[model samples]
Target: MRLYNRDWTRREIEERVGRIDQIGGIQRVRGAEGVEDGVELVRIRTGAGLSFDVIPSRGLDIGMSEFGGVPVGWLAPGGVAHPAYYDAQGEEWLRTAAGGLLMTCGLMNVGNPSEDGGISYGLHGRVHHLPARHVGVEGSWDGDEYEMAVKGTVDETSIFGDHLRLTREIRSRLGENVIRIRDKVENVGYTRAAHMLLYHFNFGFPLMDEHTKIDFPEATLSPREADMQVDGYDSWQSPEKGYDERVYYHRNIRSEDRASVRIRNDRFPAPSGAALPISVELSWDAATLPNLIQWKMPGQGTHVLGLEPANCVVEGRAAERERGTLVFLEPGESRHYELELKVNPGVTAP
Candidate 1:
């Protein structure tokens, strides 16, 4: 069988079908008129049955993801909130959390509210609420494979406070159910600055039901709160009427250079009745992101499982500093973080 393109030149046609490969593509679109006004979105489709939306105005966060027409991520009912509506107080950030596949936390602070050295820091920091500057999206064919990416910069600064910059790139390849995120946080001020970052990957609904199970490397699991229940840390429960959220810290001792985790729902089938078992996998460098957090909330209308990898915990910057685990970047210094999310199909439990 042969394919012909009437719109392409001879050379272009040859390049198009040179390797029998599928090329992924990206498109820029305006937010829905009444749903997400004043927001810009980039819709990406990898020929491998993976698709997602990226909000360039919201720190380039992934707004939603799907595999074979089935949503793999959760979204807040409030939709995307503009930066002008962001509240730095506790719990107020949730009003505009978006709750997508990826919600980047931190550039200055993260976690619960706290007062450190007389400065009050709010919950989960302010990076996600900040708009990205110099946003650009592009797609290209790399050798026999096609790749697409969106790049941008987010600045978290003040007149006399910390001045940090985050340059982020979200990339995906054709015929691959994977999304890769690369970030570089630089201290642009004249003094050392405390930095915290967390990649909050949230899954919801059919992908995160009671039958869903989380698998991670052998690690020490510590409850965020002493009174928190630990009945089934690796498995989820049905959504309750008034269930309280639970947080656990996974301190993985990697036997290799990299650490990985997976959330699989073997009982969930593809929307097309295909034998594609649904699963999401996260892989990252253990040295860069030394901490992992599992946020389980099985509450009605708020069901989600967050697999967060971070440089610090969610105990606020003050607590992290007190524990000497708060990461700091010196003037003119920078740090890089790499994370990958892969969607697996046709995989069954052992």
Candidate 2:
């Protein structure tokens, strides 16, 4: 495995494709590859459980990245669950999770680009697609495969926009085939305003196909997106019927011992066709991330899944008010949300 550092400019670039200067928040520290294993899963501590290795290989594509011999898909990049377009618009972008993991909290770009979302600010946000400022080198390890881990943070007024203080410790391990997220959010703001925090996990399609299903904790879901708008790719719908804007509200689904859900593509070659499950285990506070969004984009090409745990359901403040999902932090208050993604790989059920 290879080790290095990720600064602030690189921290938020985790959303979508890399735009180091356009990103904010956390950044990456370690990167490596695996010889025996095709996909050298690294141990990255991202609250998003998703990130990109952003390999600037010696002789590879400036956009492509991989430390050793690991599968590009694993370290490639993941996407959020929603289409940037909501109201006949395009995809939107918020502040990303950083560490070159590639993230944007909101839609891709529907009406206008994030730089001009018509909201005075930019489309995604000031730190929507920015990059992180290299802080320091983290660590590297080697075994059957390679594992990489790093650390970065978001200063006040980045993504949170609340003059919030963000600290992230990202770790990626090789061979283990799984990454863990141990994170914390501190509200260093003066006024107590409503906040929305969600992880926009992007998984490659084919890897996400007709066989995929999204599971949740069964809490009273906020509500469906009124604008059953369209996005990229097609979908491998479930056996159920009346599949228009399908959503699930759960309570115990987030329990560590809960059933797993996934977004698998029958055309893809992962575990089986629509067989691999993407499950969520609750930690921190299950009630906060009560609502889970399941989206399917099949034929659009580059299929992916977004398992979002939002503080607010759909309308942010409106959903939070209805679902009572809003979490408040005093002038010096802080809250932490922990989520872990265990790749069943070939295991249909976990």
Candidate 3:
């Protein structure tokens, strides 16, 4: 296995460490306090300077993530609150959004709040706030390669309403600064159900600042609001007070099978006292996730850059239905989505 920039045999590495976990492994923990009480957390550590937390109690979504002791994921002020605090009404979902590394946005709806078929739908969706069952976590070696993974199933179903089940698996290697998320959404009920999915990948400072640059394949960019159409769509700035959030939809992404968006910062101070060019790339299956949403909000106390990939836009389910863009899943039907997030510790600034 490769660790700390060198190849080593199991015997040699084991001799130097008291326990394998001291180098890299998985540990299960529980949040104990106020909003985070009783939250189950699966902490993963890769010897290659990558670490993250996976919350099974919160739809098996990823929370804090770091590379080389530097935060690669943006954290909301309230932190990872317990799912019990989730409010599924109108805009109240933001209270417990917990803006983490990855937030799974849907099953029945994704976007604004609205009324559909005499039923009121909330802001994003209930998927992120749903608890997972049959959660599993493991770390094993596969012929010189150490692999760590966590799996869970989250169901969004009522008595006779939508019965959608999302089976998610998040995996990483011992010597890699990468995380791969695989999800399968299935309509397990007898009737057809509406489906909308989005993966919200948020990035914040000091990884995102004025020196950061975003790169992606050529695509048609459409601002969510007409007045939001301005310059600097590929650059960033420091946190500004009272700055309004701007969202843009990228359509017709030019990629063969998958599309990737990269954010790079040229002047990130490393733990080694060096200014390293840090880069993080998010890639997804373009065929399944056909659209990308760029959420630029460099506002004070809310500074974040959201690189979201989804099947539907954030304009809400009703608007999607009206535009003939809503997706539906029939009984026993399933859809698969794949995503990878990789961190490059050192890169030549372009």
Model 2 TM-score, all chains together: 0.54
Q: On residues 10-101, what C-alpha lDDT tens digit does candidate 2 reach at each position?
A: 22323433632221122332333322112212233322223344221100001221212221131222321111222222232322112122
* Candidate 2 or 1, higher lDDT: 1
Q: How would you order the candidates by TM-score, starting with the best?
A: 3, 1, 2
* Reference-based TM-score, model 1: 0.92
Against the hidden reference, what TM-scores do the models get? 0.92, 0.54, 0.98
Off by over 4 Å in 1: 1-24
List, residue by residue over 1-350, the lDDT tens digit for candidate 3. 87778898777877899987988899999999989999999999998988999999899998998887888889999889999999999988899998889988988889899788888889989999999999989998777788899998999999968899999999999888889999999999999899999998899888888999999667888999988855888899988989988999998888889999999888887888788987888999999999999999999989999999999999999999999999999999999999999888787354
Residue 119 local lDDT, model 2: 29
Instruction: Note the residue pairs that clash in candidate 3.
Output: none
Which regions of candidate 2 are displaced past 4 Å?
Answer: 1-130, 140-147, 156-161, 213-288, 318-324
- lDDT by residue (tens digit), candidate 1, 72-126: 9988887877767788887788888889899999987888887887777778888
Give candidate 1's error at residue 35 in angstroms: 6.3
Query: Which candidate has the highest TM-score of all?
Result: 3
